[model samples]
Target: MSRNAEHDHSLVMGLDFGTDSVRALVVDAATGEELAGEVAYYRRWSAGMYCDPAENRFRQHPLDYIEGMEAAVRGALAKLPPGAAARVVGIGVDTTGSTPAPVDVHGRPLALLPEFSENPNAMFILWKDHTAVEEAGEINHAARHWGGTDFTKYVGGVYSSEWFWAKILHVLRHDEDVRSAAFSWVEQCDWIPALLTGTEDPRRIKRSRCAAGHKAMWHEDWGGLPPEEFLVHIDPLLQGLPGRLYTATYTADKPAGRLTPAWAERLGLPPGIPVAVGAVDAHVGAVGGGITPGVLVKIMGTSTCDIMVVPKEKIGTKLISGICGQVDGSVIPGLIGLEAGQSAYGDVYAWFKELLSWPLKALLPESSLVNRETGEKLRRELEDDLLRRLSEEAAWIPAGSTGLLALDWLNGRRTPYADQTLKGAVVGLTLGSTAPKVFRALVEATAFGSKAINEHLMKEGLEIREVIALGGIARKNDFVMQVLADVLDMPIKVAAADQACALGAAMFGAVAAGLYPKVEEAQKKMGRGFSQAYTPDPEKAATYQNLYKDYLNLGKMLEAAWSSAGEATPLR
Candidate 1:
């Protein structure tokens, strides 16, 4: 535990590729003390304009990821001491998963070619982009009809638009160029490493067990991926997709390959430094937050992902429905990793802010007059005032006070029911309702959503002994966390680290660099965090119970209406 620079021997870099930016963290491999970090925001572009609202399609140039990664790494390296660069032993990357990008035989992005540069099909299809709903529905129907035990058991009963194969099929059927040029439809989590090593071998592309199990429907008992027949039944073009899928999917700590000479030279790292395979941002965040088995780790951001690790023996037969996936060794070895989530959280907050019609000019001056002198001081004062007022108003309203309940489907449902066609709704809102009241109800609605998933997990025989919350929203917003605690009737433990995802990535880097023998060991040594647990208030809990009952009834009522109208029927 020497703090002196002369005694520092081990260092690693963790790179996180998020939705809007790439972040790099340089850390002490042995101590997990963050030494330096940097962030590079993706440059927004409207140059091609291929994202059609009518079609629900969204795409991004692959070059954005490349440029963003380089910038982030270079910027972070600049922050480190001159000698620290050479001491960096390994690199690890974590990214939002199931974001598929089409590439050629040489591992070159098809979108980089001039002819396909403007084509949406050639670019990366983000996980949130739900344009493939139709394709996903078809896959689900076909899987059900086939009744394959292997396929149904592994994927928790349905394929989703937020996965690799579904997105690939959608593009292939709609764009002839994509079908012809897509030598491989790769996941972003895997592709980043492939790009770094300059290798396109399907064998060489190391898939994270986390992504493959949760998103791509890979499992151990079935070996890897669904049988070839299942793929053919879904789409003729997918006949050989299984073979193209990675054979030796690895854990987050496993080294995929050494950095290529070009990447090493460009990033100021050793050429042969080991690079761990990519992982889901949320899963890595769990490791970073110091969560062990039976502790549900909620990575709350624009979206929220709930991750838990459990002994294989504890996976009882409550039908464990609604969970995204339960893959063995996906997070920690000798345990089953469970993933469940809500598609929206902080994004809903952003939406509410956007809906506020007041101009900044009008609000800023009044906000400053109320408390501050300088512009920065005024802005901080205003934000504090607004958040405090909102929280107070929200707290005053009883759990069922608004007499309104909402479905947290602003981004679509991800767990317990993986329905993308589902839309958000707020029922029992009257003309007398105010914006703060509505906003409070919306917050409660998300809490209810989390409760639903928790119940599903309980039913599946996994006893959630504890709840650990991590991410900006969890740490910054006390009101939301308290609401969640009341709704779940369980104490919520918030992680101390501001950058849980980055810290988790660094832990993986430590293992890859051989500073630690395994991921669990690295996690124990490197993960540093204090937990803030919120005990449920009996009065609030009682109120939420009644409100939750009403919410369930309303949900059923809405479903019946949709069924009666035949709106729930398949489009095709």
Candidate 2:
């Protein structure tokens, strides 16, 4: 089929770079139809590549980003009908954050160079990496009394180890080679779009408001970023970094740049296709979940990110404290996107599943399950279908009947207090407790965390009129959704789009490409609808009220332990 340059409409491409894989989607820009899509797993990442889980160190090579992007985009494009590629006029991107990397003066991720090829210090720091725990604490300590203004005020009162500067500080402190070679740091979300458009010059690449405001402490009040004085106080190494970094942050509503000849040829696309500025996956997922004013959208995957948008006028003088951030035009062009979430949602559940199944493999021989065909089937059921079966049985158990409660902090807490040092806890466990019973308590703990976030938002003067759930857990697990509804006493709507994050990105692409005048217009026409709504049961809600109090008590006890351990009093 011959490519037609005149064909400027009907399709747009959206790329979402997640922790495990990168997903590419081709969508009907006018109708919000998901025409074709594919996911490309990072081959290196799948092999436990560049990661030290024991040390909470996770890194992704820039090669993984390039390879995943080309593979997924080509794979998705190949699935489309004839002439679909020519119809593509715009591209959008979203990625996990604050996944940042130290870069050369040319804006190339240091890991991309031959000298730094095998250096973990040169790689993009994964959002889950907690290698900067001490640096984050130091930042919090310094920012609290950083002379005139507290730079950490906008980002939940407490600085987190999982953010931009913290990881940079960690690398600077530990890796002398990296510190000497690195001129600046760049977020994954910001770098990808710039890379596609061949805007590798450090001063030319457009930075994303979604990433900068939420993770990098960029605000207009004191100019672009937290003053150099504040950063210097945290660490003298950060002296000239901010000046080398970014001054202005742009929202995704605008185009970062057009695709370059090299990237276009590599990805089989037109050279001039508009590329929208990058954003965090959850913020765009909010758009795909039909996010509007007062609607809370939860992107529940490995982690959970809660998103909501409100007008600037509606949030006049009141600061929505204790959130990831409130960034203007992050989700919508004319609104503010508020973010808050648990660091580990589905991750916490996955941890329990592994903990419960370890004995089944270690104590009993795997050969026993493989000996007979039926035994193999039983083993498969135990390994793969465990979560489903547990959830089913847990549904039968009454609220608080488990007599066991768990803290959903296996990784750490993200919002209400962004504490990365908190550990998980299980209380009232007896020999009689079964895996299913304990699983029920774990689910309740996650729901309770969501409730706390909602309460915090309300306390900060934001009214949540609606709740929308998106991502893998929200779609496949009806039991979890129902329980979440019961706990919050709020109706929850599951987004219809299978690739909601990518779809939201497509909406931004449409606007940036000039197919739509504004993001709201693009979203209104191209965004997916609701698939299902979960309503709270009155009885379950009442029972959860009492259980929530116990949860509070348990949380207080845990917080006290942190305090005794010499941590600062949490602001949650």
Candidate 3:
């Protein structure tokens, strides 16, 4: 048989619920060949429903997930060959972490009910949302003083606004309707699988080990989540919530349950097919990118999620500080998955792009130079090509040539101490500075942020042997990749698969379906190798080393200024 013919085999579907959209990827189970995929953007989210950028509040209705999933699956299936849908043996799911929603006793999101349908507090609190900053700070303080188990220890000794408990607490305290109606909270990652498998009871939902351990402070050492005593101490509003939530969590490789007949019919798939327990996208993406011991797999997209695995025996009893979390079996079974990242990466570029497009946004619709429709089309054309054009020009400028310096904290810092209250800064701007120069500084700032994460890991005694890159920014942006290599002084390889997170989900799906004995075996067979490699330039690396010190110094100065003035308050 030809290579194409040989690729035909039993298929698995990987559904990735990203911030803006859901992606459905179909892959050959035996060979890891990517056959078809489709992307479905959430209509409500695209139109800016239930989000306030100024307030740092981002929410997504459960209907968006349901619609995106069904649409993406059906669209992807349409692109596959004959009988391909019938050959699908398993399905896997991944979603953004810490994206939890208030749910009723029946395990349905509160936003799904008529009364709470339009309430932003009832929707899924997006992972990037920072509305819970005060709540996170309160939890952090109480964990240290409550005279109980320190639930924040495993999660870098700090609770973040962008996590499970803090978001729920924020909603409960602020919104009376949601507070009274919410019987339990469910992470988007865990809830999706439960939705597919027809699990109605919140207690029966198979919680994700990745989501629980990393964000919700679930630990076997602590028996489960932080005790009721500790929670009530933090806030009396949290009383009895733990018992209503969950006591156990399952890894992504395990099956949550078989797909229910109703969902199977809706998705055009076989009933009783295994549905792997859901996990955060970055953990699953790390697996898809072939992450191994000491390999730092960076999922660089809207934000950056840095993932590395260490053997349980090697990392036993040692907690790494100033990261997202280190969870056992979060990425791969029987290993310790360590996650750290920036709260903003590509979003920084997008922010700059939006800033530059203000003239068009302000002037275009009212222009007499063209028809309104024509003006809109031209405006979009320029906006869409803005980043690519900026990157091309920026690449020509030598390192540190532009005197401008930037801090990659537009969406707050996620690692080396997670601080959502910190705002982004751009300093040392001169009259000679151009758009491209400012853009270059922003790109370099993001790269510097990544290096800080790597250095922090090494400082904490976790060795980084190699760096693997995946996600949209990694695959599509060579200029950014080269800058990252120079900043980190390490070679980076991009994963071959375009939809690596989805592909990783499919690997777990294969294991859940009993096609592979373990996740490692599935990865060995299905993993697509690296497509491109970026090597650090010695001259550029030396220049960046000096610039990095300046970056750190500036950060400290700004932090001190904010601390003294008490100006770094969270957006309300």
Q: Which parts of model 3 have CA positions greater than 4 angstroms off?
A: 1-8, 563-572
Model 3 weakest lDDT span, ten residues long: 563-572
The prediction achieving the highest TM-score against the true structure is 3
Reference-based TM-score of each model: 0.90, 0.95, 0.97
- List, residue by residue over 378-413, the lDDT tens digit for candidate 1: 555555466557767888877777877887777767
Residue 416 error for model 2, in Å? 0.3
The Cα local distance difference test for each model comes to 0.78, 0.87, 0.92
Candidate 2 per-residue C-alpha lDDT over 344-449 given as tens digits, one digit per residue, 9 for 90 to 100: 8998888888887786666555554355566556656787888898899999998878898788877877878788888778899899988888899999999998
> Model 3: clashing residue pairs?
none
* Candidate 1 residue pairs in backbone clash: 322-416
| lDDT of residue 545 for candidate 2 | 87
The candidate that wins on lDDT is: 3
Give the Å shift of residue 48 in candidate 2.
1.2
